[model samples]
Target: MKKIILGSLFLCASTAYADRVDNVQTEGVLSSQITMTVADITCHINQGLGISQQIHIPTISTNDLRTGNTKSVEVPLMVDCQASNDQPGSIAIHLVPAGVSTVSGDHTITTSLDSVGLELAWKDTSLPALIIGNTEFTPAQATNNVWDLSLIARPVLLAGKNVTEGNYNASLAIKVTYY
Candidate 1:
């Protein structure tokens, strides 16, 4: 009789337990677009200036460098600003020289010719000549916002230095400011 009562009590306890359940739901959305824009000034290669060019230098003996020498080549600076901004906006131009010189108001021109010190200058037809690391704001010609400025690359030798015979090359960075 005690066993029967114990079995009945165990069955009742098992039935007294309860069950639990849980659930979750979620939703997400992402919709966006991106756009990029530039300033109202553009550098273009309509002719010869916008591209790399080689200027021939006058041959000189080692002693000639003591007095300094100059070599120059003519090129055109073409730019398209017709639709660059609202109306015919103005622009500013400057040049940064590529060299290893640390002298104030002086820049270097990296070239294959070793032991030779050289300087570069930009001669605009409408403005005074600007050396490397200089800025200027003068337009040579503009028609409907198409700028056609004339430029000359003038390289001069540093005094009291000797230059070996070889070809030298350097690229100038042109910075344009628009208003």
Candidate 2:
């Protein structure tokens, strides 16, 4: 019988793969971290939405503040720096006055009509009196990075009292720093 039917069909395919079986399971693990920084210099004031710039003192007549005659307005300070290789260092300017602090000490800065106050000079009169919160160090008439400041806002009569006609305002804040 053909060699006993091929030895019983190879013994039923080796007992059907020796009754098969296999199973596995195992999992977990992952991570991360990074940091960076780079800066040589950068500055932007009066042109960075810091209220841009505005000053307009004209109509004054408490007999022109009793014959002292005052009226000055021109507060323009534009600083734009970006140094890396051009090397623009040394620039510190800060004049913050949102009112109050007037007896004319820190160069006045208080107005809403209370004997009127607003005197912050530096029209090249040896550049030095712009102190309201103090942080002066301005001497950059023409650097490649730019820093042009020619400010003067006068309308002082603080403490002379009794010169109120109503409606007078003052508010200033400009701070720039670079090393």
Candidate 3:
């Protein structure tokens, strides 16, 4: 009788352990993926100079009028990204002008204006981050899932009466990253 009782107890313990192991093995695997896409990316400039000759903007048309410049021209840039299973995604835009130092990177514009005594300035007075919308995917904390971003750059030309007339050119680069 004693031997039978001991055998029964061992059998019950083994069955319980097997059931626990089986439950763990049946648990599903957890996994995720992330992806980003730029739905539409474009840029344009607006000039504020009053004199046509002083307003020879390059991003748009050569024939653009410079008369009655109200505010410096506004350049608009758009970017879009999407993620499948990722948490955060971010993008950085770099604008570099010809003859400017690449070391400065995205901090400043290096292109030289032909017009003498003409002052050029960026509209980002507050130096605020160019965020797409209020949707959150900012340069700091990028939003999860799909994000749409739009940014505008304003260029103001402070030209004197004796400003020179010529064509100015610059280049910009846009980069995106995900984690």
Could you tell me every candidate's TM-score relative to the true structure?
A: 0.49, 0.30, 0.34
lDDT tens per residue, model 2, 1-179: 86788888888876765656333233556566667435565556556655355566788888776566887777777666644443344666677766544435667677777788877776656344556444444445546666766578778677657777776887766666655
Q: What lDDT does candidate 3 reach at residue 175?
A: 39
Off by over 4 Å in 3: 1-76, 83-89, 98-112, 116-149, 158-162
Q: Candidate 1, overall lDDT?
A: 0.53
**Worst-scoring 10-residue span by lDDT in model 1:** 17-26
What lDDT, from 0 to 1, does candidate 3 have?
A: 0.37
Query: What's the CA error at residue 111 for candidate 2, in Å?
Result: 8.5
The lDDT of each candidate is 0.53, 0.65, 0.37
lDDT of 3 at 116: 19
Q: On a 0 to 100 scale, what is the lDDT of residue 144 in model 3?
A: 30
List CA RMSD, all candidates.
22.3, 25.5, 19.8
Best by TM-score: 1
Better of 1 and 2 by TM-score: 1
What lDDT, from 0 to 1, does candidate 2 have? 0.65
Candidate 1 per-residue lDDT over residues 1-179, each given as its tens digit: 87999999999876664232223234568788989655445445544255455446566555555445455566556666554444334556666554543222344454445545445444444344354444544444466667655466444554444556655655556665655
What lDDT does candidate 3 reach at residue 8?
98
